[model samples]
Target: MKKKKIAICHYRVGGTDGVSLEIEKRKQILEKHGCEVKLIAGSRSKGADYAIDELEWDQGVVPIIKENGFVYFNRKDLEDDELKRKMNKISDRILNKLDEIQRIEKFDAVLIHNIFSFGSHLAAAKPFAKWVEKHKLPCIATHHDFYWERNEFDIVRNEYVRNYMKKFMPPKSKYIEHITINSLARRELKKRFNIDSYILPDIFNFNQKPWKKDSFNKDPLKELKIKSTDIIVLQATRVLPRKGVELAMDFTKTLQKKIDELKSKKLYNGKKINADPNVILLIAGYTEDMDHDYLLKIKAKAFDDKIHIKFISNVIKANRAYRQRIKIYSLWDIYVHADIVTFPSIWEGWGNQFIEAIFAKKPIVVFEYPVFKEDIKREGYNIISLGDELETLENGLHKAPQENIQKAVQKSIRWLIDKNLNKKLEENFAIGKKYHGYKILEDFLVKKLGL
Candidate 1:
């Protein structure tokens, strides 16, 4: 096939958010398969064929989101004129940039990510969806999760904007090859609007060589006050109720008791258990809900229950930049140090944590969110499963060593474990590359857009 110029649009790609990481991986794979790419968003991109500044609405502050360590860029607070103006300015710039792209290059297609599926649609995403509705330009909306899944948005009008945010999209979206991250999302898309989408779970660059954690990652940990010897049990998901962060605490607590039991018996053959655990659960990242006072209260209560949890959102703000001003580090830094990852999300669009755990070659304990069953679970992911109650946990953990995961723990510890989701990782590797990778996208272009 001849080369094609593809421009991707969405929110910022600088951080370790699921969207950012997926787009980055997609770009690398697409480039390998021969496609010129560029970026457009409120955030600048070092990875682009041409970078355009659409608007900085997402870059501004929403008093509510700010208190919760989040920014509502495209979601203007509306009460503030300056913020509103900034948002308008960014939206206008995005349209203008689209016009410019059309004028300059072949601009074969614009792979829109998450823009039409959430309030974060700032740049070319919203209007792009509208434009694609008219088939103005060949495009696709690769949704990790949809806006309707969020509980807060019940009564919304702006049909264009609302449809853009939720899985309940208009018939026009169907013309654009709807792409989802998990099977649950695909089924929901079908059930709600009869729209079928391709599944593109979050992916990592498994083909490329990885670098060792160096001074940049080291500095963030130093400031985080995390000890090198401490086993890092990370809840590497967004701070939301569905994420089930307390489960991470509960598991750590369980492990603590086992550790203590092991110590008391002085047996290392998985025979004796320890009474006290030296494990640490790091609750990292910002919660979008500023009014999460209830969440705060609950978190405090969890702490009181002896779950050694650490909040490192501010420390790892956006990236591992040492501007000497902020103590930001990439989420990858934590993944690099994880002894185990806890992702007990009630729901996930595609699941970035699953991708991270596999690529980093670590163990993970996750809930069987319906998406797991629908999307990648069957491919092979032998993870420690957690039912609603704590009863199933012991059985899950007791077989940790024999439990076959995609990769083994590099640490010296060994025990019987479950090997349920190991193959899911490889499936993830191939599917992610196909669904989001350049090759699959090329097929989508021909089949759906007829480009």
Candidate 2:
């Protein structure tokens, strides 16, 4: 049998973002199923086979295109006509580069990630759709997020850009199939664009060797200057407004108030809680490009509350590797050190870190976001949920209700001290394996490709 060559395309690949991580996972599964997979991206990163600079969100003409099209229109700098021209120009460049890659690779199908649905790189849509049409390529458009879901892309600038978004953002064609990461997104796409899509939730490799303390990962705590006795609450999402990291700080602060009470109890690992233990929130995700202000706001709140929080994205990479002779840990490596994982995201297409915590067999404290409620909660995983409601504080940060926070804090302590902690974790891991393991994704791809 001839191997199916698949090209997985994204604006950025081989990075820590959910889409990039998903691409890697899908690539691995596809290759495992005897498909030759090639990674094509807008920016250069580890594991990218080809890069088209114009497709990048933050580089080349993309930012300018986004400013004129999605952001406030700058008529003085780039008029609507000029902006459209520039968009078309970049689109052609991308098309040409993609065509060149196709000529060499002769891919059987193209699996595109987020380029059509996200408003971040509008220029790539038309060219990508054109190339697929020209090649008669079977395309799987996987939408991680949509423009309407984001406030930043609310203003469409003009009718031309609006038309482009409508027509080519996800161009309707017989050769194309659409996929959404959750049921909500699937319904939303059908409701908005009348486009039907398959639901492919985030998945993990549950059968792989467990992430544990090794020589490479053993020093993350010491390197971060964190005490071994401190209770590490891991927040493993990128720094963004919707991530609701401030809620994690609030939870940690409330949990810190019970340090003395914890000191009297034995930890799940059969060790006593420290006499003066600190509940540290170790954030191990990079700050997104436009969310520096949000990061600052979170830092300010942490300072005011005196929450012991550390941002260690500098030491975390997409995979374990050495940079400049210094060992950088993967997200999984950090998960090995986590006593509890906090996934307090207000919004997510699908929860990657949540599944990761379950895979790592660590207790999770999660905000019951919409996707979790609609797609994941029904699976009956054991989790410390922050309830599905939120209250906005004066500073514009969202928080779970006071009672819910206290309840979650109490449950977290019990999980930390209870000798039966592995029972709950194992149950959660089993549920995750049943619903979201790699085999689930492999079967989906096998059917999608007709292989």
Candidate 3:
């Protein structure tokens, strides 16, 4: 039998972001199952044969979306005619480009990531939806997060915006298969839009050997001016408000106090430990998509709290490479060097960093976000909890309790010093491999695609 040709489409691919990482995994699984896979996106990549400039979620689409008025509070604010005109221009452009791709590759199936759910790039939605429907394309729309779930999209008042969001943002048709990363998203889609979707949790490559301090990465902390004695708690997410990075800062401050108390009592190799290790919160992800303002606010909070946060996004890239002056490190390198991983997100479509921490066999401090509480907690993997509740400030930044922060700090100390805890960490690896492993995704895709 001939293999099916699958095209994976997204705003961008081959990046460190969760959606890009998930797309890479999906492509691997499908290829392993005898499917010929192709990459398509807005970004330029050596792997993508069909890259379109306008398909990106960028300034080009911003005007159209603003005209559509989905983020406005009143219908009167929407210039539907202008919105339609702008969207039509981009739609026609995309449709023509897609036609060229169709002629060249003739993909048997299309896998779209986040286009429907993000609700950005309103311009691409109309023509892309029309093309897919008219061609009766076999598409699986994998929704990571919905616009409705975000506060920014709450002001959708214009009927045109609402209708366009409902219809084309991800057109619901019998030919299209919908999938959500978590069960909560599936429930919400069904409740709100009468749309049913398959629940496919995000996966990790558990079969691979655990991340170790390789020669290439062994001196990363030293290179970054992070002392060997420093207890590095890494916040390996992008700088964004919803990420609740302020919580990590609060945790670091509390953890610093706890470490100060522990320094007097902590013993190493049956002797008193003398070295003073600073508690450093290292941020490894970049601030893109209008997060510069959020980054400034986090810096101010970190300064006020006297917390040390090293922004190392410039040295980190989607993939490891030698740049002009310094060498870029993969996200995995940072994980390999981390003494502790902090995932204090107030919201997530799915927690990519959480699973990555698990894969690395590192002790983690987790904020029990809604998806984590509802879909993930039942498995009962041991992690230092930041509790389920958050205090939102007037500025909308979230803070974890000082008590929860202290608890996680103590747990991390134990994880770092106690040789006995190795057994527990090993058990965590076993559980992670069982549930979130690549084999699970491979098997799921095989069954779903009947490959």
What is the clash count of model 3? 0
Residue-level lDDT of model 1, residues 300-392, one tens digit each, is 756677876788777664456655676567777777766667877766776777767666655667766677767666666546666433222
Candidate 3 lDDT, tens digit per residue, 228-325? 66777899998888888888888888778877655644432232434586888999988875678889889989888899889999888877778896
Best model per TM-score: 2
Model 1: residues with Cα > 4 Å off, grouped in runs: 1-3, 44-94, 104-106, 119-126, 133-135, 157-175, 210-224, 262-277, 289-295, 313-330, 388-451
Q: Candidate 3, residue 379: CA error in Å?
A: 0.7
Q: Give the CA lDDT, 0 to 100, for residue 49 in model 3.
A: 58
Superposed Cα deviation of residue 70, candidate 2 (Å): 3.0
lDDT (Cα atoms) of all candidates against the true structure:
0.57, 0.88, 0.79
**Tens-digit lDDT track of model 2 for 278-330:** 89899999897777888899999999999999999998888888889988889
Candidate 2, poorest ten consecutive residues by summed lDDT? 69-78
Give all candidate RMSDs, comma-separated. 7.8, 1.6, 2.6
C-alpha-based local distance difference test score of model 1: 0.57
Query: By summed lDDT, which 10 consecutive residues of candidate 3 come out lowest?
Result: 265-274
